[model samples]
Target: MNSSLSIRSFAEYVEQFTSLLIDYSPKLISALIILFVGLYAIRIINRLVRKIMIKRELDPTLSKFLADSLLWALRLLLFVSFISKLGIETSSFVAILGAAGLAIGLSLQGSLSNFAGGMLIILFKPFRVGDTIEAQGVIGTVLEIQIFVTKLITGNNQTIFVPNGILSNGVIINYSMQGNRRADLVFSLSYDTNIKTAKDIVMQVMQNHPKVLKNPAPTVAVKSLTDSAIILAINPWAKNADFGAMASDVLENCKEAFDAAGIVTQPYVRESSKA
Candidate 1:
């Protein structure tokens, strides 16, 4: 009798298992189909997006990052669709995901902000790699723009990593955006020096420099008169690349020119023994 009872119990278990499989087979098959079709569609969409990015000449780093992010997001949506199609209660799962996302967002607030700022920068392109820019009280050539930070190489050759959040929100002076830059220089002359002669000498030095822009023309005007000396403001325009070199050369050449022309510069007098 015990043997018979065991055989009957085994048969009932097999019957229940078969019944469950039969009831869920169509749903399982439909879910599989949806998964395959969704994957194919995602692949096509990803390829199209990549092509658009390439055509637009977008930053490679930004393009790849966006592509991967989109791919994963699509895959996650597909997963939810597949599970829900199988008659599984997905509200709890979705709530769990939302809660987890909120927690992670709270934990990485700074990083997320930086990421958003980077996206804005990449899209708007206020500055590009190799451009000289001044921001956050640091002036440097942009080395690279990453998702969270931007790398810059200073004039002194020091590397700096500025968070994109601050960089995007701050005032950015892109020296390279405009092809030409104006240099403001001041030279002091003694009261005995002939103003016209000093101005002519400075103008000659600037005009003779190969890098100085000739169209806008350099200007020399008496800026101010102090008790000790007369200040002359010299404004010259040059290509951004040649600005530093041209400014230095013009100053040095002007000094030599002044000496040659017998122009008297203001002499520094020590007020006290300490200097």
Candidate 2:
């Protein structure tokens, strides 16, 4: 009788275990199916988003960032849903996630601002890669536009990382947007020198420059008359890319022409009152 009682008790335990499995198996299977299907759907959605961005000619950095962000966000939602299907309390989970997100956001406020600024820049395109821009007192060509910072290669070959937050808020001068730029130069000559003759020589030098634009015509005129010297303003237009070289050439050529023509330049005197 003792052995029979023990065997019956063991059989009852097995029956109860089988009943429990039968009761929960469908739910477990459904949850797993949903998880797999959600993952596949998220991948498809991410791929579609990437294709759309490509079609729109979006920046590659922005496109990849957006795709990954969307993918993870969708996967997180799917995870929450899958947990709920498994009879777990997703409200508490969502609350925990929200609190965590809030904490992270608070801790990274500056970074978030830069991220937002980057988004704005990518959307509006204030300046693009390879464009020469001046911002935050640094002048350089834009090397890359990232989510947090913009990389610039300065004329001195220094690579500078400027925060996008400042870039978006600050004044950005894009020199590459304009097809041409004006080269303004000031030349001083002694008051005793013939102003008309100096102006003619400077104008001739500019006109002969190969890079100088001829349609707008170069201007050489007396800008101001000082006690020590008369200042001549030389204004010439050149292609944006050629502005620097053209200015240097003009300066060198003008100096040589002035020397050849025996034009006397005024010696720079710090104390003009005493002179």
Candidate 3:
């Protein structure tokens, strides 16, 4: 009998809680309705902010970021207002929230660094989506630049997510920035091979290739004469879009031309990549 009485007394707060709300029924319901309105208004305002940012020519990534941040901030502010409507003390609530935020920030220091790095990327724009770049020791095609990480697809079919903090600080090589690219090909011939003949052979082959751009002209010069072969540097200017194609064509033509001209080519180890 004594245990039953103790349990009933301990649970009596539920009835009192109901009585308190009933006493302030009008204000309590009004505050809840205000909360709903505030949430709805935040949604509308978020959309409007996005539209305005787009109109003002902000970066698409930054625009979305601003919209999301604003929506959350405004919703929080509205929540405070709604609480105030229900007779809760706003100053005390804000103080508690401030303390909580400090704790959260302390726990997420690394994420904060990444977020700051992402903002820098948006502001400075080292590279964008679809730009072929080498960053953070990874060379790949950029797929997306999100708030915290960058997405990449490597040539070998691997997906990479690089943290913005590391990428923003490291060396980033953007290949597609230049309007035109030059293929830096080193063609080697026998040390005894006629220099003029070798130069003419490389130049003639580059000129004949349809994909090789002619506007900037092609350059062929004897770079050096090594113990094994004569190194001829072939720098051919081509449109950026045709760089790979022209590079591929040059190697094919050079091998054929060397065979036809009876010139000995460089060995495999000394061979340079198709630039």
Candidate 4:
């Protein structure tokens, strides 16, 4: 009879514990509902914030990052709220989140740097859209500037995507920013050709061309006498819009004049593959 009574008392104790848990079930249900509602509210708030930023003309990429970060932060807060509702301590939750963010930033330092560089480009208009520039040793026309990368269309019609961080640190040549540019031409002729005659011919060609600017006074002189040729250097300033056509025409004119005079000429080889 004593064994039976002990067993029955143990069973009653377990039953009471279970009933106690069931009685608190309403609190658990309320916590879950609060968590879901909080998350939904945060989502709505994020959308509204993004809309406002767009209306204010905030950069699109930056606005998107802000909205996503806000949403994640809100979800974390909702999680902390749920934990608190469950009668657990939440002081450490916020601290943990802070540490996590710091660790992530450290791990993604490169990406963060690129993001910062992109912001700089957008904030300061070093070169605007449709500018022809040389950057990172590649010469191209800028197509689009994004948060992480900038797109360029090369002279060969190839598409190039460059990270913003390198562009920020590296040397960039902006060729389209000036109103007028000087075309430096070094013409080579056989050492026996008369230097003064070549200069007169070049000057006459410059005068005939309508695109060449006369105010700067097209300069022409013998710069050097190489082993094979005498180099005649010429620098002419012209409106940016005339650079292409005038340069082509100048070379053609020089060839015709030299041929007519029957003056032997040396080939003008490129000293640098690119400038």
Count the clashes in each prediction.
Answer: 0, 0, 0, 0
Ranking by TM-score: 3, 2, 1, 4
Better of 3 and 4 by lDDT: 3
lDDT of 3 by residue, 107-218 (tens): 9998888888889988898887777788777888888778899889997989999998888888899887777888899877776688888888888998898878787899
lDDT of each: 0.91, 0.89, 0.85, 0.83
Runs of candidate 2 with Cα error greater than 4 angstroms are: 1-48, 58-69, 78-88, 266-275
Which ranking of candidates, highest lDDT first? 1, 2, 3, 4
TM-score of each: 0.73, 0.76, 0.84, 0.63
Taking the tens digit of each residue's C-alpha lDDT, what string does model 4 give over 124-226?
7576567778998898888887878888999799999989888877888888898677788878797668888888988888888899998877888888877
- Report the Cα RMSD per candidate: 5.2, 5.2, 5.5, 7.8
- Model 1 per-residue lDDT tens digits across residues 206-268: 888999999788999999988778899999999989999999998899889888887777553
Quantify how close model 3 is to the true structure by its C-alpha RMSD in Å: 5.5
What is the RMSD, in Å, between candidate 4 and the native fold over all Cα? 7.8
Which segments of candidate 4 are over 4 A away from where they belong? 1-97, 267-275
- After the best TM-score superposition of candidate 4, give how far the Cα of residue 251 lies from its true spot, in angstroms: 1.8
lDDT of 2 by residue, 1-275 (tens): 99999999999999999999999888889999999999999988998999999999987777877887898889888998899888899989889989999999999999999998888888888988888999999999999988889999999999999998988999999998877888889888876678788888998999889999996888988898886778889999999889999999998898888888888675445554763
Evaluate model 3: give its lDDT. Answer: 0.85
Candidate 4: residue 65 lDDT (0-100): 61
Q: Kindly provide the TM-score of model 3 when superposed on the true structure, using C-alpha atoms.
A: 0.84
Worst 10 residues of 3 by lDDT: 266-275
* Backbone clash tally (model 2): 0
